[model samples]
Target: MGLPLLMLASGSAALAAPAAAANDETCRPTIESPWVRAAPPGAKSLAAYLVLRNGCGTAVEVVDVESLDFGTPMIHRTVEEGGVSRMRPAGKLVLAPGESLRFEPGGLHLMLMQPLRPLAEGDVARVRLVLADGRRLFAQFPVRRSAP
Candidate 1:
């Protein structure tokens, strides 16, 4: 009985190692030039853009995007079908090693909806990129009228 219990403990320890490694600094993705576009007064929705780069050796998925400043913030991609451009909510985003995904106007972007308050230029918005492995990367995006 003691031998079996010891083996079980050893197996459990091994299983916990990967969960600890999920938050490893080396595996964390990087974000560059994160900024939110200033919206007109009374506007219910706004757009934010950023560049997400994965420098890790393995692929990672950005499971969700969230913010406390807005009621709903989601990842969106602009698509063109039959020469008509439409914006749609982009599902989970997966980044391969050494890949940099851009969120820019007329392309992929973050849809900031239901602003809690009017955000003006020079203000900053706090957002988080939640990874599939339970790691949350927080970012502050400055509000601007144009691309930074």
Candidate 2:
């Protein structure tokens, strides 16, 4: 009924040109196959997982993630300690050269809260990822009933 709480970060606004360029020596992040898992009816929380491919020789740290659909879109990791599983904020996520990080269930994922609306099958959401180097990568996530 109202505007979505999730919105993309503005980190890339200043570096749009360079970020769009391919294979830039400074910093570059290749995002591929991003999608949101299906949620049950009346579900208040959801997770978005994707693969971040680092092209630059140096490592890139994901400083923050912004989404207008959630009250707080943060980077969180599932920690299993003492045989107990809990979710905590991941201050920063790092990616090395040619490295691809997977954000999947039961692991690191984007903790989306207070969805603007229930995610239905075949729905697509736009998300923006901000890298520590001030690069913003835009991505669209398809809402799938299940993930392989």
Candidate 3:
């Protein structure tokens, strides 16, 4: 049997945290400091950020992400071309062994679109990342009033 899928949502003061270990030893990615920006009223989308750390001896690829709070969750990156800033799809993120990747403002992030409901500060959103090795990692991202 496989590990159960985790559902993380916020209503209380304490946020949900992801598991520190994986069911299989070959793949273990630790997620830390997950958070979503508090969207303005009627806003259509928001960005989520976190740190992904590979603790295994091999590389791991994060192929996709899913969330129940939004209609779609896509990996995205902010780019500047000809002095114009734009957002683009980031196909996949590969992490080398013992590597840590940070998703922050003005960099790689998760584009959460078509929110099922409005989000505010202190709200928690549930997100799951799909890996190339067929492993799913769950995380809880808190909605913050400002970027951390």
Candidate 4:
């Protein structure tokens, strides 16, 4: 009887360990230091920057972006061609396990166009990041008067 009890306890412990690991993996990527550049009055669009950290063991892809304050929110990247800078669409951003991606000026960023209303310094905009795995994460980006 004593041996049977010990075996049962050890089996339960082994089962619980896997369950804890699964829980950790389920907690997808995290967004850090999110902010939006404040545009001048009557400007058609603005830029947003942030850092995405993947805490899970598998890779995750950001497929789409949505914002209530802007008509269209899309990922974009800045490229230099013969010293001329141009902006282009970034199809999808994939973050590997334990990796971090930065979206900053002169690099990858979010192009927020057609503001639903005028935005000013210190205002907050809510943006949703849709992952390819069907997980949606919401972030509040504060409007800054200047770039960092």
RMSD of 2: 13.6
Which digits, one per residue and each the tens of the lDDT, describe model 3 over residues 1-148?
A: 1333232224221332222233355457999999999989888899999999998977899999999899988999999989998999986689999999998999899999989988888999999989887888899999997766
Tens-digit lDDT track of model 4 for 1-148: 9999999999999989976775454577998999999888998999999999998888889998999999998999999989999999986688989999999999999999999988899999999888886678899999997664
lDDT of each: 0.91, 0.78, 0.86, 0.89
Per-residue C-alpha lDDT of model 1 across residues 12-114, encoded as one tens digit per residue: 9999998767667666899899999998888898899999999998888987888989999898899999999999888779999999999999999999999
Query: All candidates: CA RMSD in angstroms?
Result: 2.7, 13.6, 13.4, 4.4
- Model 4: worst 10 consecutive residues (lDDT sum): 18-27
Query: Clash pairs of candidate 1?
Result: none
User: 90, model 1: CA deviation in Å?
Assistant: 1.1
Which tens-of-lDDT digit does each residue in 1-148 have in candidate 2?
A: 1333222334445468655554464556887888888789888888888888987777788988877666777789999989999998876688878889988889988887788877787988777888765678888888886674
TM-score of 2: 0.76
Quick one: best lDDT, which candidate?
A: 1
TM-score of model 1 relative to the true fold? 0.85
Q: Candidate 4: which stretches are off by over 4 Å?
A: 1-25
- What RMSD value applies to candidate 1? 2.7
The residue-level lDDT of candidate 2 at 63 comes to 87
Q: How far off is model 4, as Cα RMSD? A: 4.4
